[model samples]
Target: MLTAHTAEGELVILTRSQSLESLRERRKQESFYCPQCKEQLILKVGDLVIPHFAHYQQSSCRNSFSEGESPAHLLGKSQLYEFFSHHTPAVKLEPFLPDIQQRPDLLVVWGDTEVPVEFQCSTISTSLVRQRNAGYYLLNMLPVWIILTPQSIQTSTADILTLRLSSFLQFFIRQIPNRMSVLLTYHPQSERFYYLSPIIHLQGSTYAARHLTLSLHKQTVPFSLPSSPSQTDIRELALHYQSARRKYLRTVIAYNQKGIHNQFLRACYEMRIQPVQLPAWIGVPVQGQEAFRQSDCEWQLLFVAAVRETRKSPDQLNTSFFHTFIKQFDGEPDDLLAACRSYGDFLREERIDIYRMDRFTDGDFVYEVLSGRFLAMYAKN
Candidate 1:
């Protein structure tokens, strides 16, 4: 805790000017109390750590001290409060919201807009994150979740950062321009904010993210969706998709002890289709399809197989077929629909007459390749 109340109800903050000797002198004469609970607090001044107040061992002040509130968390919270307070006088530190029964790390009010800034320094469950987000939404407040750095992520490649996707981290994924989603984190030690944009789910619990670091002192933190993808962004996405596909294939092949266990591979073999050299249109990357359990290549192969089946009876391309095709996999309907639309766009580029139907009442529409010429036009780019 940075600020505490004295016995006279006077607020005393451990200022930067105060050294160990000064803190020791002040502690000898004045008594401190927890700002939230109004319980007595002891001041500790040490050479290794910052000067702060701590509740006594037997104290049960849940309101004053949260669970797992480490020294780093305390320091980060204080620094964030100071940062916002410097910019706006309306900033309040740890303001209790009666309606939601939650106290955000900091609340900044600007006219009609109230932003609850949460500096998350620890890993938390997705349900808790959703509950908090839902609570804020119900109160008509935009909650900003800023992940505290160092522990939140790790550097992967020259341009990528790997973030372990917890439910908390997933809540922060924002879709930017050019059909890419990103997560943001703040590093207080360096006074820099990082954006892990265009994040691609590599496999379970991990994502390959393109990193963008911004100086907190220079740039305002972005709260809006980013603009369209650049050529470089698209190129990076292509590379990531290809690499992910290769990795997925290697794992499947290694695990197929009693011959290929995957039904998709068996179907491909019957059609004499090489898994790695699927047609260009088959494995193209689509925006917002990360919810699908299957890899991009796997889903694309399934779609291609559907196209081949439809060629047998063109009139069979209807709502029932579409629903059955999608039901074969475990994926979000909305995400599958989005990927279908993207696939339709690719077909148009190739001069194929595939159309995405929207009249279906069961769910969102699916794409249909109009002619068998779609198969003959296939080429590996």
Candidate 2:
């Protein structure tokens, strides 16, 4: 909101180079109005805050430009404006897109394309994200969303990072062509960017990832993303994934109430197998398994047991089998169904015989499989 309209409909932008006295003098000379709502705006000339335009308390603007803007948000917007301005003269600060009724923090025109950039600092719902993206899609312009790194966000090392998969973070995860799926975050104060690429789900909200950091000066309009995880990094993640799986097994053993209502425990009993003694393949991670609140082990073990009991070849399993199998789990069925299919595909590819689980019980072999799958899943060709 650094730009506003004058009484004569002239757009005036307040720059940081302007002195306090000049800003106060300009405020006294003429009235300022919001470009989007056309409502009279109060030009706040303060020493502490960056001078910007504000709407009245009673204004009913659909844009809502002046509401809930934090200092970090304001400073970050200004910084990005300057950053983009360095590369392209086509960049604009707080331009109102009339067709969509949304005003992005900054807009940059790349060739014939207009890209609306959002510098998000606060937490918002996924629905809001979808709404904004939908608005941009109406004009066939893809908006670029850059998140401000939280003060609480931590990095285990320059290369290793672990994050809780909050809904907010999930919304920022991007899967780009020729690169890994990544979450991009920026630190406004330090002008640093963090790229968490090839993020993998361990269990629950926990994700294991490796990141690349770059100073703002070293960045471009499109920015640089880190390459996919290396084979060594994939091995490290496999170790972490295996450790989490072991911990889950321990928890299952200690917490099983042996009640008929406990479906996982009942499945263990029906299989005539102790929870701790389940084969290594029963609980392995899959690409879409994050959708399940149940442990990968519980549902996967149940799946293996059901397939074994049917005494059917892997090719014999069809849509009806998957549909009936996923009915036992809670939540949305699509991702769970996909995960089950992926597991089935892996079994078929490896020529694994579910009836002879005894041959595939070696933990070392399982580890090797986990590591190899991870490398294939994430490492760049």
Model number with the top lDDT: 2
Local accuracy of candidate 1 as per-residue lDDT tens digits, 223-307: 4343344545545545665566577776766655557579668756756655544444454445445766566667766765676
For model 2, how does the per-residue alpha-carbon lDDT over 182-278 read when each residue is reduced to its tens digit?
8888887788887877776766677767767788899986778677567677676667666777787787776775432566677778767777777
Which residue runs does candidate 1 get wrong by more than 4 Å? 10-22, 150-157, 161-167, 221-233, 257-260, 312-321, 352-381
How many clashes (backbone N, Cα, C below 3 Å) per candidate? Answer: 5, 0
Q: What are the runs in model 2 whose C-alpha is more than 4 Å off?
A: 15-31, 45-48, 56-63, 154-158, 257-260, 291-293, 329-337, 364-381
TM-score of 1: 0.79
State how far residue 216 of model 1 sits from its true place (Å).
Answer: 2.4
